[model samples]
Target: MTWQSHLIVMPIVLPLVTAAVLLLFDERNRRLKMAINVISVVLQIAIAIELMIMAIEKAPEPMVYLIGDWPAPFGIVLVLDRLAALMLVLTSVLGLASLSFALANWYKASPNFHTIFQLLLMGLNGAFLTGDLFNLFVFFEVMLAASYGLALHGSGVARVKAGMHYIVINLVASSLFLIGVSLIYGVTGTLNMADLAQRIPDVAAQDRMLLETGAAILGIAFLIKAGMWPLNFWLTPTYSAAAAPVAAIFAVMTKVGIYVLLRLSPLMFGISSGASYGFGNHWLYFGGMVTLTFGLIGVVASQAMGRLASYSILVSSGTLLAAIGSGNTAMTAAALFYMVSSTLTIAAFFLLIELVERGQDAAANVLAVTMEAYGDEEDEEEEEEVGTLLPATLAVLGLCFAICAILLIGLPPFSGFIAKFVILSAILNGNHIAPNTAAGIDPSSWVLVGLILLSGLSALIAMTRTGIRTFWASLEGNVPRVLVREIVPVGALLLVCLSLTFAAGPVMRYMEATAHYLHTPEQYIQSVINTPRVGGKTENGK
Candidate 1:
């Protein structure tokens, strides 16, 4: 295959390779690791951009590579479809921004930080790109294992306990994932998703229900990973405890699980034969709805700034999955759009939080310095300092209030608005499912959609209330010095949100087409099975 024939491999390969090289070096070499980190991140971003361009130009043909040159249905395949490509792009953007922020605020001397970070990226990239189910599990493990370290990056009692729970719960979920895979292999005789896509329908009807049960179990595993519902008890505390940069990157982890669900749900469940999801899509639709509502409620009630923001992100995931489980192209596309928008918004928010927290620290230090110099401030001087300090930070908090409001409420001129527009249109009009859903009583998919609208409004109100209290109501202190490192990350997020207003057409189109591919696994199977090459080179030939 020509080099361009497999551009998708670069994102995964570069990070893993860099991690390997970094692992061999001493932890004290901060300068070298930082250089490698910057370089690898830059490359990942470049490759992602290239793949997106290729996807747009090539249309429906995705870039897939068979490891060791084995053909599809037998060998492990790495696919770079629109969804996969989008993930690669989003992952790197988050990674880059977080890395810069960490540089500004974290202890640069920590030996393990660079190695673990690279591995985390490796897991994320692999999880997004892998086509084999077992491989997906493998990548998930790889990522979460690395995540355990990052979660406790700056060791403390709170972080340790939170990370332990986070680790233990995920391990249980991973075990369940393995169980699901075992049951699937036992029933279908294949772990290759494309092959299983064809074989599951042909299984004996006696075992048909069992196959779906396994699929549902598998869906539960991914949902658990996605931080949906009761199984997600570990999310808020874990996210809140991690370092700012780690939290920023961790925001996208749930999305990877959703990406897997979006890829597999249509094949596993639905109206088609051989589907694995049992009791129909209603299970997912309703389950996702509950989680969305619960998550948003939690977001509103929570106060520690990081935890509140993290819960809001979780709520976004639930809403997105609910849209997909509605089982329609329009709905799925809307979900993907929201996925992209939410990722950007959350990353931006967390980075700003770091800046806010840092500024607070700086202001505290400055106050100490002033007090030392003044030999204790007189009441009038204290009053004057209080007045000045409060206004400046209030302005920064005002910025946070505006951005989080846009994300939490799905407000417009932002990307969230674009996503909401598409979803509401799909929900209100009903999708292809409505004509078929009426077979059962009360099959309105729109009922599930209410989960999104109401939660979104609640998140808005809640975030707005917090903003009013923190920024508009009264200020306890002054705004601190902004982190030079984070300014760019925050700037990038707001700018992208602004730009998304204009890029809505193209973004929505890509998402729609991606949803089209996911809804019809036939294209995925055929694309892999029939792809040809010169001298067994494995060219796309799509």
Candidate 2:
């Protein structure tokens, strides 16, 4: 109705509209399509920033919108809180970066690269904005559908094979998502997230089990999307096979899963007897810890650059899950902080990999592919500086390693440190819980201490290896120095991480606010439940 509402909706709508516009352009006009994509992304970024300001300056409660004037519970509800706004901002910026990354390779690769990329961004924004059960499901499908197309945009054998498996797996997961929602609705009699949050707590104990069953099913679906541990088989390779831009932004695909997990963790399954496995928080932490550990080992153990970056993404993801599972409010907060950090850093990493590959014709020189593309010599040799890379190239790589090392290892002077510190402290101090409750973890203080210490060691070892190979040791491969196209996105992400490191005070304050908003959904639920201006009628307003 007002500007704020309009702004909140624009992020989703702009991308959808942009995708259609992009599609209408002559596919042969690759530059035109990319221009449209960049324009759409930049506009979306502006809208996200505006929404963030509004979110901070306006009232504390989320900005709620009911589609078609339908009452809150009966109609679809969209919410914009610090958390959602934060996500939109992060994804929008990263989306733009990825767009640029992909642009370099898209000109010759596919006619519809620009169109598909916009659609992917559209789905992600919609997924973040939708506050209804079915809406969330729809957005997930929207994103995956576009992803299925973009996943194979290059149409190579490797891309097709990996993309197909990625599709089939997510397809099954999608079906499971719908089934879970169907069951949830069959029991709770509502699809609105805010409404369900209230209703699920009140269902008859017998019927509540049905809700629990549905929630479990839904959890599995999200974990599959999040690429959590065992179900992540389809992830690394799909990413590795994708072109640079696609790979960079594709990293955010799991954000959809983590977003749902974080959203529902607070809303759908708040502090209830239904809180099992630490309300999924315990699993998140332990799973994340293992993921990080394994990822570190994978990176150290792997030679392929693409595969190595893929492993890094996995490690980044595990860090978030571990933070969540730790069951410390502060730890969860840290996980949230890390979520943003990991995404940007990894996106930068992938983009840089692409640039380096393109410039040096690494695939041509090292992998034996032939290419004089980009006017760079295939066998050109560049002088190496000891204990440092080419100034520009090494700086970018250094930034990547620095951010990843600090964040993953939970080192100090960065948001990662702040986040990990908060989580570790929360884990060690032992928050109060019900007597003899499962929430009462075993030897948590010491166990968490050990894990944190172990994580630190692993992070050190992993970073040491990577730093030695990429920066310290003479780069075995003669990749060209960073290209201008590559510099913007990677540089943008690296700078943001560095900024986060210095602005810990403000960032932590924001994170704490976000955590409070998530933990206490009373305000959110009440905002929607008490809403009555929908469908020009008084309905579902208890």
Candidate 3:
């Protein structure tokens, strides 16, 4: 195998090794550990970028790396394609930003914070790259295990309470994952995704119902993780309660579920899969619409910025789910673009929330709400109006908050607007709905478009309300003592969102290609199953 081939596995191995090395150090040696953690993440980002370039330039087919030189359907494999590479780069970037923010002080919340963080990255990268369902379960557990620690890292009442819920919900999801995998294996006699895709079309009539039943159970498990409505009651509380940096990294964690759904739906249940074509799509579409509506309600109702940010995540997930369920190539591409834009925006917002709230009291939100709802009757003493210069730190925070609001609201001049525009356009122009035609747009498509627009407006209202309370209403409030480290990560994340705006053309092209590739899974299947083992020898010495 070439060196580029070897890079496919480095994302997983690098973090695994770094976490092990971190265990050797004493908790007192925090600076060293932090340095090591940052360096490792930087390397991960570099490697991920290189792999992305390789995926785009050198690889027209999915790059497969066999573990122990074992061939497909028999041994573990990592498959790197345009989509997987994009996810790797996204994970690494979020990791670096979150870790940088944590180093400022959050890392001190737990001695093993850095260690657990690396494991989380390893798990995320593995989940994206793995080519088998069983290993996907294994990686899901690893990611969730690390998240449990991160969620409860600071050991606060709220954090612990929410952490326990998070743990329980994920544990149940994991159980369903295993059960589904076992059913699939029993019916198909294969756990490898590529093999399963190849066999799904021919699944015997006797077992077709069983296969789909297992698939439905598996979809439920992923939907819970994706924070789909009804299944997502735990998401808001858990995410809102997590530490700022931890929550920031977690902005991408939910996407893992979305990614798997996107990967499997087309590969295993596309038009080629006789009886199973487009299975569960209606659920995804309608369920996503409900999730989006629920999230919009939460966004408007949220009293805390943390909860608002968490709800925004649901909004992003719901949009992606709906887009994927539509099964339109254009919509999927647009969704991918929105996914990247929204994740970065939300991550920055999560990190920014901590910084913004640093100077405010615990009851500040409640006080603001109470004052707004009722009347703050006080002695009427009119004082001469005086203009005070905004402190530099507060100014930066306010500006960052405004940018986040704009992005979240899908306002103009950012990638968020571009993403939403494309998505709306795609929905209007979808196969079922022809633009400027006698049929007009379908009712479902119209509902989706309206919901998306309403969600954006709702986000604007929520963010504007929160911003006024936090920054404008509290003019006399103490300026938050923001560190360069914390602020820099938030800035970096927003800067990335801006970069996406400037590079939207190229980025959209890549996403379109990825969506096309996903829609056509035959290439992926053949590549994974037909790739020769090392030394050009199979287990049977063929």
Candidate 4:
């Protein structure tokens, strides 16, 4: 393989290798561990960016690596395409931000923090790159195991309770995952996704029922992880109870489920599937709408900023699921843009909430009481100040909060607005609609449009209330004492969101190309299934 081709596996390998090495280090070696973790994540980000460029320019076709030079259906394979590379970059960015936040004493609070974090990233990268169902399951377990450790880190009674629920729920999902994979493999005689896709159409009629039954079970597992409503009552509480940095890194964890759906749905049940065409799209659409509604309710009802951030994750996931279900190229492209914007925005908010809420409870209580009694705290005298000065910490936190509100509420002059605008416009314009959905800007589209607008309003109201209580209406607000390391990570993440607003054109084009490739998976199928095996030999040893 060429140098560029070799980079395909580095996302998984580099993290696994780093995690193993970090395990050998003493817990007290803080300075060295910090330096190594920083360098490792930075290099991971650099590699991810390079691989994305390669996917876009050097190889639009996936770069497939056959382990041990074995044939396609028999060997373990890693495939890198535009979507996978984009996800890798997203994970690396989140990892870097979360790690920086951890360096502000969260790492020191927990033993083996660096090791577990790296292992989490290793699992995430592996899940994105792996070419088969079994390896995906393996990576899922790796990620869930590390997350179990991280979720309970800096343990408290609340943390322990939430983490237990988190652990139990995911353990059940993993069991369901195993059962589903077993059933599918039993019917298809292959664990490889591409191979399964190729053979699914030819399965015997008696077994096709079993195949879809397995697929449905698998979909339930993914939906649970994605925090779909009804199945996801555990997410908000669990995430809210996690430490700041752990919560931030978890911003990408929900996306892992969305990524699987996006990757496999089309390949496994696309137009080529005949009887199985649009198998799960209907459930995805309705379930996503319901999830979005529940998320909005939670957002409006949330009193704490952490809970708000957690619900925002559900909102983001639901939006993506609905868009994917719609199967509109333009909407899906816009959803991809929104996914990046929302994940970065929420991750920053999680970190920022820790800083902003520091030592401000007394003032927040006073403001809440004042508003409850008088309905408004400001008088004309106080409202007309011309040269009021704000504390530096308060100013920074307020600015961060404002940016987050704009992003969360889909306000103008940010990527969030741009993304939603693109999606709503696509739906209104009737470019495409999913099967069973209404035609020509029908009731379902109208319902989605109304829900999107309402969800933003709900978020806006919630953030407005929270901001006023914490920053504006408070009688004696404390200027949060934030460290440079912590603040910088939050700033960096928000700035990336800002950059997305500026670079929407190029970014949207890339997403459009990605959506195009995803909808038409023939190229991916051919690339994976027909690739030369190990030792440069074809399956027939030609």
Candidate 5:
């Protein structure tokens, strides 16, 4: 009931209101719409940061806001914990960067671009904050609907083709989401997440299998969104085909699935859930390893930068899923750090691809691949000028490209390297195993470690090859006419990654606390169920 509790809802409401206001303006008033959109997103970032600080200070206990002044297990609620707050801030930052980039040119692609963009943010913030299973489904649909428009924003042959596939795949996922929700609701008689967590352990034996069946179906739906191996065939092409800014924001869409898994898996199926303990974990583990391996292959085989960036997203997702499946507190914390670092890097890479590809012929990639496959056959008369100075714009692009490569490859002196190192150390040290046990580390742990290292090496090769073709091989290529507006967003994203590198200690501490909190489901369930409604009335009216 405090004033600060009200801030939890603004992230969702502000964008919803802004999108409605945007609809009132004529398409010709693009500058006005863009200005409004930018201001709204900036306010969201401010609000998200404030919420994050509050969540940190509050630690362990979540801030719950009840809708309609109704108590838990009966009414809608928004829960803001350390993890949810972190996601809110991440989503807001990515939104601002992507929107800024779009304003430069891509916004002109459609009259409703700004409108759809705000809706997407609304859906993302809602999904992150909602405490009810049904509301989560609602938000998922909203996010997917908005993404459909954004994917086809430019409406080229490739974009449309990929957009259709994206639409179809998500539609199927949404259907599965609904069916799973219905099954769980029927078995448990509750749709509120906290309520379900409290009720899960008490479900009758006859209904245990049914409950898990529903949960498994639900997991499959989320895995599809997370771009897990076989379910992810549609991902690379669809992401590669999206408009630059749209694709940049879509980077976080996959994480939405990961976030839900991080929240629900522990809360509903942890050690406390008698027969259901550790359900679906092995699937996540093996699936993640395969996804990582497939992504590494894609990264090395990709001929286009867009596809390469898309594959890198799969790599990030696979790593997170595997770490989560391990169920190690230290590994989960490290994965959270890696999640933030990789998301920002991939988003920046998507935006940067637009700038780097500008003024280049479409056949350039093909030609570069061909030369590598066969020969360039350059004439001796066409002597290369080895000492020529690079243009300032090209130099800047090259530098940004190199930084992205380092981040993606998990090389030293960056957050990516720190995250990977923490994960590897956590696994190798057997932190998850009991101190008194004689058993060694799990073999699956070794497989995960190998996959992570090999993925990094593959990424290094792919990025280096792409960079040489983009910056060095095409010496005569025209320097792109980059705009300050466009370049600034990319710079801002990379700067945040660099900030993460320098501030790894504090960030890792926060993530560790979050992971610990997640492992303790009792605290979360108590906080949610015990939160009193307005006027100091309990759900039981005591």
Candidate 6:
């Protein structure tokens, strides 16, 4: 009833309402639609920031909103904890940036761009806020439905082909999602995440295998969404073919899978799940390693900046998966930090890629020919001040590109480096392991270390090569004609990542507190299940 109670649902409702209003207008009203879309997104960002502040100030008690004043387990509830609030903030900011980039002209590419865009945000926010498994599935479908439209927006052959693949794969994933939830509900008699957490330990011995089986199948669906290893082949192509703004917003899509795993893994299968404690940890660890390795290979082999950015998403996903699977509270906390940094950095890169590549191919070809013809004499050309102050347009693109490279490669004086350092330090210092568990660093942790370093190195090589070809080697090209709208979004995204570097202390503190709550889910479970019916009248009283 109070305004504060409404905060939990505003993120989902605002977008949904705005979207409905926009759909009333015809394609001829593009300006009106965009104006509405931009204002809605800006407001959502403000709301998300306030909710995050509330979550932090309130600590472990999540803000829960019951729809229609219904009781928990009987009606839908939206919960906003530290984790959910953090995700909401990320989603809102990404939506704002992507929409701004689209305003430069991508919105006109499709009649339904604004509609689908708002629906996508609604789904994303809903997925983060929902407190039950069934609603999670509903939100997944909503998000995927919008994504199908966005992926196919431009109507190019490549876009259509890639979108088709994306659709088919996700359709199958959705089916598995439903089947898995059905199995879990069939045995547990509950779909509420908190209720499931409470009941998992009490599952009959005969049904334990069935429960694990269902969870495994469910995880497969999540992993596919997260773009994990062998299942992720569709991601790079799809992302590479999408419109720039679509690709940019999609940087958070894979993170949705990571979010579910982080949320449910701890709440349902944490230290409380009896023999099922830490279930699927090994799968996550090994799968993440393979995914990270595959992503690094893809990055190195990618000739196009779009494909490289796509692979970077995979690397980001794998890093988080591995961190979560590590079962180390500190490591998970650091991964949370890294997730925000990587997602924002990659989103900026996606938008920048299109701008940087504009009118560049001709110059690249000419430079290549010049190099081949000059052969040994090319050293003289290379020695010329490659860093000579660039033109304004090129200068902005080059600076953004350089920052992306630094972030992706986990280089110094940036949030990316700080994040990676936190993870490595947690591992080396044995923050999560007992002395008896390992003499020094566990071999698994060592493998993680090697993978982290090697992947960063590979990413550095790939991004550096692309940057030189696109910016440095393309010096002969005309200055890219980037609009202020496009530049502002990309710059804002990069600045957010930069700000993370300065705010690392407070951010890490928040992450540590979040990780603490995750590993100890008693409060979360109790708070949700013990919640009274919203109205004074219970079913009997009514």
TM-scores of all candidate predictions against the true structure: 0.89, 0.87, 0.97, 0.95, 0.97, 0.95
Q: Relative to the true structure, how large is the alpha-carbon lDDT of every model?
A: 0.76, 0.74, 0.92, 0.88, 0.91, 0.89
Tens digits of per-residue lDDT for model 5 on 89-121?
Answer: 999999999999998899998779999999999
lDDT by residue for model 1 over 1-542, one digit each (tens)?
66886677777788889988888778668778888988999889999889878876765766668877777778888877888888888999889988887877574625668878989999999998888898999899999999998888886899999999998888888988988888888898888877777777688988877777777778788888787787778888888888888888998998887888887877555345543443446666667777887788887777556877888877887777677667778888888888888888887887777666653443544454355447654556433433433465457556765876786588776787777778877776656444334454234555655666777777776776656544543334446576556677777766777777798888788888888878877767777766554347425743
Runs of candidate 4 exceeding 4 Å displacement: 362-388, 431-439, 537-542
Error of 3 at 403 (Å): 0.2
* Model 5 collision count: 0
lDDT by residue for model 2 (51-105), tens: 8888887647888877777777877777888888888999899888877766666
Deviation in angstroms for 333 in model 3? Answer: 0.2
Q: Which stretch of 10 consecutive residues in model 6 shows the poorest summed lDDT?
A: 430-439
Model 4, span 265-315: residue lDDT tens: 989988887688788887888788899999999999888789999999988
lDDT of 3 by residue, 479-542 (tens): 9899998899999999999999899999999999999999999999999998887867547967
What would the TM-score be for candidate 2 when compared with the true structure?
0.87
Candidate 3 differs from the real structure by a C-alpha RMSD in angstroms, to one decimal, of 1.8
What lDDT would candidate 5 get against the real structure?
0.91
Clashing pairs in 6: none
lDDT of 4: 0.88
Model 2, which residues run further than 4 Å from truth? Answer: 272-286, 358-413, 430-445, 470-477, 534-542
**Residue 22 of model 6: what lDDT?**
93
What does candidate 6's lDDT look like per residue over 246-293, in tens digits?
A: 999999999999999999888888988988998998889778888998
> Which segments of model 5 are wrong by more than 4 Å?
378-381, 431-439, 536-542
Model 4 lDDT-worst window of ten:
430-439
Candidate 1 matches the true fold with a TM-score of: 0.89
Which scores better on lDDT, 3 or 4?
A: 3
